[model samples]
Target: MLLKSPWKPRLADTEATVAERLVQALADDIAAGTLETGDRLPAHRELAWALEIGIGTVTKAYAILERRGLVRGVKGRGTFVAAYQARQGTLIDLSINAPPPILSHRALARSLMAISRKVDADYFTLYASPAGHLEHRRLLARWLETLGLVADPARLVLTGGAQQALALAFDLVCGRDGVILTERLTYPGAITLCRHTGLRMRGVAIDDEGMVPSSLAEALDSEGTSRRRAVYVTPTLHNPTTATMTLARREAIADICRLHDVPIIEDGVYGSGTEGTPIAMLAPERCLHVSSLSKTISPGLRVGVLLVTPAMECLATTALQALPFSPSPLSCCVIEDWLANGTIRSVRLELKREAARRSELAKALLADRTLVSHPDAYQAWLPMPREEADMFASSAASLGIAVTPPSAVMVAPEESDSGVRLCLGGASFDDLTRALSLLSGIGRSTRPL
Candidate 1:
């Protein structure tokens, strides 16, 4: 006895094939609330008969729906709508590594209104220096002071975002043929930038405390003294591994770089001022510190700051000038207002609370697994071999939970240490919980194909 399904979706009249149209029609009904949770669907044969389509077409659509987490099937019972479909179950993307939204629309509106009242037309029409306006530079220097980085305004160059800032740092230290030494697993952007600039990037070993000093020394020694080289490190809250270097390790890395006469590009994009002292402070003469407000404040706010030594100041400014344009003056003003009025501080506090909550949730849900995370970090890493990591990510994606693959974060293709990164900050708390629960189950399986 088949239960009658109330859904009678008419496929959209378009170029899509019969199967694709069926999938889209069912998806539309699910999203529009026409089909709801626990609502039983017609049997494959029944739907095929009613739609005058092949049974295989109906079967394909149903399989697609199940993989998308839109529907589910029981062993004895027929297929039914999944619970996720009722509550915005389009795609639970855990791939983007960013902080959760803590700022409200009202607050953003108020800030924008305040900025409009404070600035005049010249603020928008006038072209500023390549190193940014003097006042804006001072504001950034002052804010960095709160983070224990005593910066000089003259050495600071504002860029579009941390990504741009990183490119500037790479230009300052490494030229076209220069070599870059980084952790075994590093930020994906660095890998892309190296490839674009025709820079040779070599992977050094990393442990629980970020980059290993001994491996860094070996890599530097192998490059020899004649080659132009730089060492890039995220000493605080490393991206994929979530490893923060201790003070002693930072000193060791700085010492090695100094001995090799190589500059250091320290990326603190994930640091919140609480993570240990930056490596730049220890090797101020050769280190270029890069950070931005994307993670803590708003990802859309494209403002970043680069701190360079006095010796590299002129070269960095030249690099900035070489770019086609400068960072948005309006965006700079917004950051200035936020910093001066302590809006950024308040926002940071809120972000801390939200991130901590999510991190705890992820930790609790994946407690049994080998998880690497920090109390204040928005991302976590599950260490595994390459083959297993790929299998795990593939399985999670099939269930509509997107995660960062091991290849995206690995510096070297054949690097023995590899794993997938779980971005907990992007999804809602409920969705995060559900995804993590599913991941936990998938991890436990010996073969999660």
Candidate 2:
């Protein structure tokens, strides 16, 4: 009988160097157990021929694997897997709302190098305008246009990230002692911001299509006093529920806000390329669109864009100035390079593909459960009773899996609508599969709280 081939590398076509790609393929196989501890890799020439690359590239890849302690090579023999031992108490975190790790170090290095070539003393010494650099603003405006949002660059402001953007929006629309209407189940960060700023949040009812229009209208109408208030909404891949508002739904919400003359703080952090035109387009005069590259691109980039109506631009910029600092010029340079060279597009495409794949996997694993998720969302919502959600979260924690607790997303602690959100992007594919299986099994058993 013919012996099985030593190894068949499967390279992912990400934005990485050939040597880096080769190393990644080998490392992935070893991690996935496709290559055993003692499995000998094919000869360098053999792999180079099979992969249609230079022998030097293959050699460089092997050196990297050895340095990473994933493989070992013998002079007379060939390279063998030397998989590292698993840590004793490692935790698999599934609570962070982030994209899968697809942006390679090589890609970031290339961007950094490009930035270095253009760096000057002013780049470090000067404080950027409250809205960030003018060129950066212009670049972001053009970028937003690709997502179906048209805006004047003058009205665009660069923030540290979406959190800061939200802060700026909240300050501009509703200062201290104001009320902001949000989904009954909303982002935890928003809840924290409200508490920290002495602003009150009123929860609005939601359905499969996000915030209900009638509920918002009622909330607006119920404002007995003349205190300032605004509507904050996430219309695409809503946190914890994966709800994307329909175009008609968005229009209705916009009309209500317009009728009430309430400004909208549109949190589009997870809104890039998911679904629906931004509500900002419908009511350009009163929407403050808050979005960041942290969700779609590298979070470490710390770059966010805020698009404000012309009337609100001055206030927004002033609020940013009151803050201690703005997005650094160095970070802005990376953003510019990424946009100019199409690196952002490549990373986002890979991220979307990975997110879709993970969502499918989660859906299949929990087919019997009530899971609310979108094909492009990095998280899946498993709606359950409040007690049941809490119990499940505890059980998952015991099994070394961390999930977002229902309370983290609830606008009010006493509300009955509750569920735990499983973020699919933070963990490895294998770890995600294992954790979901445990969750499915836990759901079936009558475990006590």
Candidate 3:
């Protein structure tokens, strides 16, 4: 009879120590879901002998796992999955894009309260018109001026949020079967919007600087066959990769869009933190800019401001007709009061401070590791060795940390890479710090084959 081979664990070439090997086995089992929540693991000596490792190494590995709260040891019984193990799941969530917690500012809170007192009616009673409050539009215009994007308050339209703004823009720009050009790894929401509307979305190549000029040119050249209508971009402080294109690249893209007679929808959601004139400032005549108070202030507000060229006012108004009858008047009033009374400025300063702190923490934790991010960005892009992105994400999840592997944010479903995006801005500083600590440990820990 043939003898069954002894149980063996796959180990990375760089990690040869028996202690690292044992840790790898535990990590692999956890990731594979074989050692599930509350599942009792084999005794230390049994596992060590089965994997052909020294008992001392097994002891050390178990000690490390215990410290991380992955397993528990009892006086009379063998080690088992800790009762608290379920709480240590996933970190570094890259799936959802969320702003950091708004640092509390007494002045802003007082201002909002003051506004609420003067409104006479409850917030729900005021949001009956789709055009939003007139005062809110005026305040938004003033804020736009500060950002160097001049606009007339009469032309501004408020929506639920940036996604709503994009949806409205789509309703105005594309009819049934219309086509739009977008970067290969563009925001997923845009893709979904096109799909829902029966519109076609064509992907264009992008370089480190952003969407390549040549790719846009190629897509535009196929006008008769493809009939590209609009182009969308996240120009400054871009999502996922955190890439910020230079003025020269922006001008080139603008010129290309102008040449092709295509409208450009610029998502300036992350631009508030960056100090420079927006691409909208350069091509306001042909660009439709969508911005929000969520990233800079509070997402719960759900107010999105749309800035359009004077000639496009009618289009914007018509598009707004298809959306909810009106935006929340209370949200607009609060934003208006915040902008006019200097509360917005105070809130922005708080955001900058928090962003700076989190960015620094991320850099410190991932030092010597390859990460692409901006000091003010809410997320970081990590390129890992081999195709271990999924494995790393699974390991992090088992550790109570959430992350998005490359497949989650791919521009083209066919394209693949070994990278993941880690968000740093969504949790409290203490929670974020703890998550980062766990992430750093994983980065330093051994990987299994």
Between candidates 1 and 3, which one is better according to lDDT? 1
TM-score of each: 0.80, 0.78, 0.76
Candidate 2 lDDT by residue in tens digits, 387-435: 5665566556545677887777888767766899999998889989988
In Å, residue 327's CA in model 3 sits off its true spot by 2.7
| Pick by lDDT: 2 or 3, better one | 2
Q: Between the candidate structures 1 and 2, which one is better when assessed by TM-score? A: 1
On a 0 to 100 scale, what is the lDDT of residue 325 in model 2? 37
Q: Best by TM-score, which number?
A: 1
Q: Please, what are the lDDT tens digits per residue for candidate 1 over residues 27-134? A: 657656688788888888888988899999999888866766668998767889887522236778899888887778998888889999887677577777888888
Best-first order by lDDT:
1, 2, 3
Sorted by TM-score, highest first, which candidate order results? Answer: 1, 2, 3
- Which stretches in model 3 have alpha-carbon errors above 4 Å? 1-94, 103-109, 120-129, 223-228, 384-387, 444-449
Task: Tell me each candidate's RMSD, in Å, in order.
Answer: 8.4, 17.2, 9.3
In terms of lDDT, which candidate is strongest? 1
Q: Give stretches of model 1 more than 4 Å off.
A: 1-88, 446-449
